[model samples]
Target: MGKLTRILSTAALSAAIASVSLTAAADGTTNWRMATPWSGGPWLERDAQSFATHVRELSNGSINIEVFPGGTLGSALKVTDSVKSGVAQVSHNYINYDYGKDQTTALLAGHSSGLTPEEFMLWMYKGGGAELYEQYRLDKFGVVAFPCSILGTEIFLHSNKPVRTLEDFKGLRLRTSGAWAEIASRLGASTVVLAGSEIYSALERGVIDAAEWGSPEMNRPTGFQDVAKYVVLPGIHQSGGVLECQINKKVWDGLNPQQQTVLRDAAKLSVFDSWLSSSYADLKAYEELKNGKNEIVRLDPSFIKAVYEETTKWEDEYAGKNEWFKRVLDSQRTFKKDMQSWPEYRLQIGVSEL
Candidate 1:
């Protein structure tokens, strides 16, 4: 009705629009501190860094993740507690590291007794493994978990002395952990559990005769080849291992749906990047090691058969006692059995009859 009234109304509308725009721009902006157990390795640290970068990019800088390598926030083995206590908003760690807290973690982290890495990833992504993992985290530690890294078969063992047969493991002091430690003990090798950071020094100082850290790509950066001359193949003890990013439940719940989706997608991307990088690096590393002084040893077929037999027995014994272990193990085994026909059929159809 009046010139002054019209001018005031336009100004008020502009102020309201500016306020909404600012709020929308600032929404879901989060800075999360991420910790990892890997201190010096190439793959682990690189994977964590790339995952952080992916999250920030995917969220359009709304989420910023800062990663701290192993021992900076705390011991890698204690990363679970670090996330739970809110010392860190997130952590990259192997689930089996917390097996002492919940034995079922071994099944989720690294139990090679049953499935290969590809099979395990399939079960985790397509089958019900992801839900089970999330439930395990919520039920046991009050945290949220994502499978951030999945490694192919690792080096079974890197030894100072050649181990050609099952009996060669006798009296050998080996550095390993989880159910594999139990299996090593059963095989008459004295098992010593050491942190990844300590493996090189332990082997160099002759404190341990052998160790099994990861793939050639992972282990090469750690200088295991310098200390141990024998690189064993077919990492049966840790067939397909997974590293997960654990986030505080409260922090995870505080995120909006879009932020949560970015986090999950970023983790999945890290898994792909890590597997591809490590696979390529491992092939190159194998070539280097083969050309160099270190000897690559494939365990004798008889010895491998014996190890498998012992591993099966160990699984049977544990399944009888632990419900969670039995449940996860059975799930994997069933999946493996059901999928076996596909590979067999493919091989049959692809072969020429000539």
Candidate 2:
């Protein structure tokens, strides 16, 4: 080859290599798809939207999350598998929705510990449950878990007939979510499992005599009160349940440490935001219901005690049969016992507090 031709070829090669290196360095921004089971108007949907915004702000637009609400990717039940199988890069849903995958996953939502939303947040994040979750549940699914949000104590049963006593719940066909349905069934109510969006129609059509959707404020928009005039108070089943944000393992590892930290902080903030929404909405809903002539009946203390005893039975039976679940419950119970000493009374309350 001519000397001039060789010099030109070497210069072109160097320039091409440098261009490729620059391109790689500039690939700092990451775009992820997040799937949510919540409909566009639900508080959880708002939570996801806020989380996406915070993530963008924290990462300075270097990381972008696109949310698909209404289970556009898949139903709430499919969230765990979707992220695990790489069908979605991330998912937002309650841990109880995936109880079958690993019973331990539902421990956070279970009635056993009687954790308030805030205490659950502290335990799930600062306490060792977060570590164990990452170690067990997420690792098993090839994903990572983040405590994204919470719904404080589910809305009590909105019923056609008032449920003030244990006798009233007998033969009552009530719609519930997750393991709570099982608990309700054992409590002598005929339990029907239905999604939140469907509860209104179900109640109206006599498919369910009663239901617990969420906080009263959250449920009011669902039109439950329009169909059922009775609003039962004091949620016993889901006392401020925790919801999780799950990321595909490979997608999580690809992010830079700074980007990951931003995501973690964003999710943590979302938890607080969701808790506040529930608290504010419940207070407002209570006032509205009272003024609107809706009968708000607190469950009798006797019934509450009976329900707690039954829940303990359920927990004991499951713990005895499932070793992994047993370990998680034991760990959570220990944590709860320790948290009782915390200055916050929210940490100290139990089913008795209801």
Candidate 3:
């Protein structure tokens, strides 16, 4: 073949390859969706909107994702199935909502053993909890789970009456959820599981005398204070709550490596931001509630200790019955115990809290 002809043929081959690559990139970019369990609510709204915006921008407008708020696409509980069955490409839902499918999920919702928000975040992100969570999600649920947000510990009792002692909980109709309901029921509170939206009316009509929702920031909007005058401090049941964002396994596998990396990075960043921001929000809400003349009270240390002991026992019993929960909890406990002394050692050396 002539040299000129050979050069032209090579150029044509290169052009064809470039065209195929461009087509593949375009196709991959336009094919993704994320559903969130936040329906115009501030917490989920802000993060979900941020994620959708980042997804589009990072992909250079090549990738497009639509965020379907809770109930807009489906109920929060339906999200897992929606993703699994390919009805949705992705979703953000509470792990506890799926506890029926796997008890380990609810167990991970809050540490019955009392890991603070800071402790839980560190354990999940830096201390090996992520790997365990991934195993549970992938092996059991057929989903790619990411710990995207932590709404601080479920703070103390908000009620129309005071809970001065453990005995005060007896026969009290408390609105609660997840494994806490089981624990609370055992403690003699008539636990009623109600959605956040329903709490206001229930509290108003005296359907439920008390309810433990999210942190002050999360609960403030629910108008719980409007009906219940007493706000309890120092959350016990949920020292911290982990919210997960999951993508369908098949959908996740279908993405290009670059897309996968983008998602993973965004999710990790979101968690860090969410945790820090939530702390600030909660602190602000606590100040506002107290200043607004709301009756605020902290449980006595004695009561706190008693509740913690009972909660830990519940955790051990439940963990024993479920091997997966047992593994995750044992791993978390071991990791935390190994690192527990570091904070004290640093403190003794005159290390600054900052």
Q: Model 2's lDDT to the true fold?
A: 0.75
How do the residues 21-125 of candidate 2 rate in per-residue lDDT, one tens digit apiece?
212225676666677777666545678887888888998887777788756666656877777766577777777777766566667654534677777877877
lDDT of 3 by residue, 1-354 (tens): 699999999899757533433133435556455666677675567666566666677777776667777775556667887778665677777888887777788656774567777777788878888778877988888889877777687667789888767788789999987777887887788999887789899989999889888788888888888898899877887887677778878767877999887877776777777877878887888788889857887877787787777777877887878889889878877876877787765554334665
TM-score of each: 0.86, 0.84, 0.86
In model 3, state the lDDT of residue 52: 62
Q: What lDDT would each prediction earn against the true structure?
A: 0.81, 0.75, 0.76
Ranking by lDDT: 1, 3, 2
Clashes of 2: 2
Query: Candidate 1, TM-score vs. the true structure?
Result: 0.86
Candidate 1: count of backbone clashes, pairs at least 3 residues apart or interchain: 0
Q: What is the RMSD of candidate 1?
A: 11.1
- RMSD (Cα, Å) for all candidates, in order, is 11.1, 9.7, 11.0
Q: Between candidates 1 and 2, which one is better according to TM-score?
A: 1
**For each candidate, how many residue pairs have backbone atoms clashing (under 3 Å)?**
0, 2, 1
**Which whole-number lDDT from 0 to 100 does residue 248 have in model 2?**
80
